[model samples]
Target: MKLPDPPTEKSFPSPLHHPRTATMIGRWLGIAVVICFLTGLFSHFQQQTPSWLDIPTRPASLYRVTQGLHVLTGTVSVPLLLAKLWTVYPKLFAKLPWPPSRKALGTVLERLSILVLVAAMALELFIGFLNTLQWYPWPFPFKETHYALAWIIIGALLVHLAVKLPLITAHWRATPADRTPIATHPESLPPAITGLTRRGLFRTVVGAGTLVGIASIGQSVPAFGPIAVLAPRRPNVGPQGLPVNRTAKDAGVTAVDADWRFTVQGPQELSYSLEELRALPQSRSNLPIACVEGWSQGARWEGIRVRDLLELCGAPKGARLRVVSMEKGGFYATSELPPQFASDPLTLLALKLNGDDLDLDHGFPARIIAPNRPGVLQTKWVHRLEVLA
Candidate 1:
């Protein structure tokens, strides 16, 4: 049987499929992407801190805020992305100019970049949202793949921006299509079938982005919890009134043995039984447990300071430290603390959380609670510390 002719651009004649609409939606999507990228970079460095990087320990909730924004922007980008795709959908059916002129060759490259951008962004948003739910149905390692996909998406996005910059500039501001009365302005006129104007489409897309943001932001902002119908986590709903991504059971940790001893190896060695740990001069920090999964909550943590512990172990000032956790099978069972974090007065070997002993899932015996650190790097169920510098 013969195949029917492919659909042409004229087949989709919704007036909202014009350049101005695409530019408007693209602007919003672009902003969200930039914010998401920068926040993600901060989180990456916080988790895998390099010796050259010196992250501050003040603003104890810095990680919480940045990570919350990361998830928020990623969530908001979904609707904007869909709207942008819809605005430009008709272009996919357009015929490129024949004879391979320079302009036609440029069109081919632009469309190719756009295709890569859409595919990568679409997949990126899909996996990113699922990650917040702590789900990984895909076979690939989520962290590394997610990290790499971000760079690819950003590069593709830059190429897309470069290709579309002229069109974007032309329609960047209000024109007859945006401002003229719809009754008289043919450019903003409703189509014979769709009965929708450009502004109407803009309003609908903006409303979608706003609603999705409101619904998903509760995972990060407790005040929005009741309205966060789409949120995967309630910030205060998990063990010890905070969400836990990895549980003691999941980490193959059942309980702390009575013979458990916390140790530190440096210029001089020191060890403490759990009771001895409690007897040390205690300090309290009001901090938040901010995980990469986008849930966070403030809690009062009482514990010995890492700097104090280092001093007791005869560690020199400004030394790097390694925190070792008893967690059985996972990355982040042991994490490094750069000198800045190790020397922070607020960085703690926390024994108590929210005025009570830590629940097993929250890391019993001792865990690291450092300012401006990712929850995974909090190093739960910590048993030993080694001075590295």
Candidate 2:
């Protein structure tokens, strides 16, 4: 008897499995991806600023806005990614080309790129959202893994765009073919009942993205604080009227005694008691403490100008500083303040926040508060400022 023919899979009909739909969703997703990538890059550099970069101290709220956008774009992308995946889910079941041809190899490679893109992006978004919540159950280091995966995702996305350029171009101005109401499908409820169409589906996807954004953005935008129920932090609800990322207790800090002193060692080593620091000419800055986790608050900070301290200690003009903190065993025990930041009049060893003495939880005694710097680099409970040329 002749060998039986192999079974063939039948195509499932759905109103969403159209190129027009995928293109529409993909465009929105692309915009989100670009925004997240650029803002994330800015945040990374703010944390690890290079010697050549002269990040400005003006506007003061620049870091706050960029970091906030980073988190917002990342969060909104979640819904867009899912909806894009669903629109093209049928493609996942497509069979590989047989008989080992060159065309088949190309097809396989394209599919492999898509796999990498999907996996990396999905994991990046998941880890990023978890990071905001201060939950880390993953074995890998969150920062390194997140950074590496970003490059991989971008690479895969570029490859995907190149491969689908023709399709994208064709659909860019093509009339909306799937304009038929979603109710026409046999399984779908009638338009009279569901009142949804392909256009409506697109609107619904955008709406989902907006809803998630609104619910979580209150962490960064104090105006929406009451509705930021889904956010991990309320910008105004924390120790000393600001959200605290790493507390003194968590940093293994014990109660500082009367012997505590703030020192600035340069060409001339100088030390001051808390009272002496208060006696020094104090300047005030309206600055925002912006964290990488997307929470920030504007505060009135009172402190001695970093420039004045440098001059008082007889440090060379435009000298860099190594800010050392009492907190133990972390990468941020000491942070380098570039010459520009060290000399900026706005840069301060803040002693008071919101007109009150610095709360230990908010970097008691003294803390570094420089413009356009990541909160992590704002060394808390500072005890020493070693002029590092």
Candidate 3:
């Protein structure tokens, strides 16, 4: 059996494959990429905070908003990307300049950059969306690969933009040509497929993007939960009416024994049994459990403040703290709380969630809940808090 011949530039005769259409869709896709990159950068730095940076400890839902936007922008980019590619894919078959001239070399380089951008972007989106689903079918480490690909995509995008600046500017606005259906060849004269005009393509792409956004955003917006068929998690669906990315069972954490106690190792060593912890002055914070995977919900959390605990333990002011958890076999089993977070009045060593003692899956004995922090860094099933200089 013989395979069919590959498609050429003329193989696709739709009037929609114009530079102006590519520009419009490409601009939207670019914006989405930029938004996704920035939000993902914030998330990355949250997990791996640099010494020079101090993540804020207010608005409590900052991570929730950013991560949600990260996922949202990434999701929206899918349709825009498809549209942009469809608009310009004919260029793939266009013959390059011959005789190995400087122009030919430049053309080759430009195409290579575009290839890198497309491949990396497609893989990045694939991995990123699946990450929200908590599924990793790929062998490569998801976080590292995803982070690295984001840089590659952005760099290639910049190169592409620089190379196509003139063309992009020329086609940035609607032109008279755009309003008229293009007839590049005789075969393309009679509408390749009925009603497949440029306007129709734009509407279809925009509609797809909107639909995906609506179906996926409910993971972060509880009001839209009913229509969130594409969402892997519902904002209000999990233990104590909140979602759980990592559970006690997965974390290798079990119910604590009667003798279990919470400890704070600082200038003054302190330990408290569960009842003793309950006896301490309690503060309530309406904070969100905002996961990096893009689901979040606000709930009342009651516990001792980290600053209060620091004071109780006679720790120095501005002391960084390490929260150690009973959770096993995970990178986030323990987390570091910087001084800003540790000293925040709303930061808590939470013992109760939503007015009830926490369930095991919700970090039963004790947990750390801080403002504007990634959910993974919230540190569940905490057993010890060690003060650092």
Cα lDDT tens digits, model 2, 135-206, are: 999999999999889999999999999999999888776464556665545776776576456787888999
Q: What are the RMSDs of all candidates, in order?
A: 2.7, 2.9, 2.2
Give lDDT tens digits, candidate 1, residues 11-41. 7755677899999899899999999999999
List per-prediction Cα lDDT, in the order shown: 0.89, 0.89, 0.89
Error of 2 at 207 (Å): 0.4
> Cα deviation of 251 in candidate 1 (Å)?
1.0
Q: Candidate 3, after superposition: displacement of residue 344 in Å?
A: 0.4
TM-scores for all candidates: the values are: 0.94, 0.94, 0.95
Regarding TM-score, does 1 or 3 come out ahead? 3
Which residue pairs in candidate 2 collide? none
Off by over 4 Å in 1: 1-5, 180-195
Best by TM-score: 3
Candidate 1 residue-pair clash tally: 0
Instruction: Give the alpha carbon lDDT tens digit for every residue of 104-133 in model 3.
Output: 999999999999999999999999999998
What lDDT is obtained when candidate 3 is compared to the true structure?
A: 0.89
